[model samples]
Target chain A: MPLVNRVKELRARHHLTQGDLAAKVGVTRQTIISLEKGSYTPSLMLAMQIARVFEEPVEFIFTIEEETE
Target chain B: MKRVIIQSLSSIILYILMAFTIASFASTVTHSLAALKSGVFVLEFNFLPFLLLIIFFVVWTIYSFRTRPNQQMGFGQWSVRMTEFSEVDEREALITAKATKAAYVSFSISVPLFMLTFFFYPLFQTAWPTYPVFALVSTLIIANLVYMTTWIRAYTR
Candidate 1:
């Protein structure tokens, strides 16, 4: 199940790498890698903060796909 | 690697101490007069513990050298400098649960085998299975504990 996220795109829009996003989000680059790799799902608070980082809604930044059910 | 080194050194020291204690006890357990009756008692001290200790040291040395520590943070690619950890997230916890479940399953499986060895095989040897059985069961338990702690540390950090 894909935990679809605008993380990469949003970060790209803001000219940020995974490391930059990770520093802003208070986590490790590997965490960003895990998030991007769909190996781990971020906490709601982290998701919300990630959305805030990109100046987007939580839904806009991260959306659950069908298989997540 | 540091943790593994520390654990190896400590377990080595402990095994040496145990070996020494076991050997010393054989001579000291009986009176000096009783020792004389069992002619050559003091002189015929068994070198079993010394032999076992040497074997353990060699095997452990090889095993320790072969076993790599699993610290992933040393790669220097991480973004955050995590200094504290108080809890784990659900996902990591689930992974920990999986490992712990494996240990529990392994432990449960050990019980029957333990009974077989303790009772059924008391007077006989069964392919030298006891040591391997003990090693495997204990290693599983220890690995599960490591997994659970690492999982907890992962997110709480």
Candidate 2:
């Protein structure tokens, strides 16, 4: 994924388990893990839902990585 | 839990009935072929097996229709509801799509190989009359299995 995310850090800050965060966001725990691992990108709605769960802007949690090239 | 059990039971029954029907038909065909070879062209038509097959089909159809998801309780509706309830979220969906793509690529490669085998059967003498059909079915089954296993493992991790 070209986008970087601090989902793990933010989730840790909120003291929420992956399952808990997933439940809050109305998704599966595997989705939360994938988000943290950067193996999968969330849809706009999912991104907004995750951001809402963390009480932060979507940009705060996810950012586009600078292209080294 | 009860619903799950019932759904599982119905699926099992349906598959069992299908297998039984197929086996019976195959055996009947074999018997007919043997009789033809012996100069006895008499063909026996067993009504009981056909009747049983029809009854099973009707029962299964009704069961499936009754379980469907929606305001009305039907098998199709129930299955739809179950699928929606168990469907992977977006992340797993992405993984599943990738796995499916991989399976399709594998299938594409296999198709040419199957065609070659079919065309070269006379030269190689390795292709039995039914080999091509069985090979095609096997390829499809393997591809689906690969996709399912890959996605399931990815999602679980």
iRMSD, per candidate, in listed order: 5.9, 2.1
Worst 10 residues of 1 chain B by lDDT: B78-87
Best by TM-score: 2
Candidate 1 segments whose C-alpha is farther than 4 A from its true place: A67-69, B1-94, B125-157
lDDT at B45 for candidate 2? 54
Residue by residue across B2-106, what tens digits does model 1's lDDT show?
332354344545445454645455445444457779775554455666676677767655554443233353434322321111113334434445545654665
Candidate 1, residue A46: the lDDT equals: 86
lDDT of 2 by residue, B1-157 (tens): 2333354445444444554555456556767898999988766655565677678768766665565433365555454543212234666557657667867887988778777777767764532443544556546655655565565666656
What does candidate 1 score on TM? Answer: 0.51
